[model samples]
Target: DAGVTQSPTHLIKTRGQHVTLRCSPISGHKSVSWYQQVLGQGPQFIFQYYEKEERGRGNFPDRFSARQFPNYSSELNVNALLLGDSALYLCASSFSERPPYFGPGTRLTVL
Candidate 1:
């Protein structure tokens, strides 16, 4: 199965640099979610956008933002990166009320 696909599987950025991560959901899926997973911790939800509208958001700073496109793909943007931002960025796709299918995720390192 094609499943979900994410770009730039690995990334390196200096503190204060901004980054944009991309995700393509499985076909027919209308809900996309973004999550951040730090070392030794479970994935923390960042945002969930469904049907091109913001559905939910987690406890993150304003520097984090995301959008879902008409095609159901999504992009997660983070500005003014901090060392603590180093983690794995995960993308999940699913039907509006079903369990999600997660992508391999993008690993980011902030120096």
Candidate 2:
């Protein structure tokens, strides 16, 4: 079976620098979600997109946002990032609202 995939296993940035993470959902999947996992913490939902439209979002600042493409691929954009924003960004996919299968994630480090 096809599996969810994410890019750049690691990233490092400054306190005010911006970052972008990418992901590709499994074949036949229509929904993609973004999550943030800080060191030693569970993943936190950031956004969910289905059919190229945002379906859900978590409690994140305006600096965090994401979008899903027609092909079920996605991009997470973070702007004016803060040190607190440093975390592992994960991408997940599911056929329904049930628990999703996740990617290995892009670890973001902010100085």
In model 1, the Cα lDDT at residue 86 comes to: 100
Give the per-residue lDDT of model 1 (tens digit) for 1-111: 699999989999999999999999999999999999999999999999999999999999999999999999999999999999999999999987999999999999999
Error of 1 at 21 (Å): 0.1
lDDT of each: 0.97, 0.92
Give the Cα-based TM-score of candidate 1 against the true structure. 0.98
Candidate 1: residue 28 lDDT (0-100): 93
TM-score of 2: 0.96
**Can you tell me which runs of candidate 1 are displaced by over 4 Å?**
none
Residue 95 alpha-carbon offset, candidate 1, angstroms: 0.9
**lDDT of model 2, residue 75:** 98
- My TM-score estimates for the predictions, one after another, are 0.98, 0.96
Clashing pairs in 1: none
Name the 10 consecutive residues with the lowest summed lDDT in model 1.
Answer: 93-102
Q: Model 1 scores what on Cα lDDT?
A: 0.97
Clashes of 2: 0
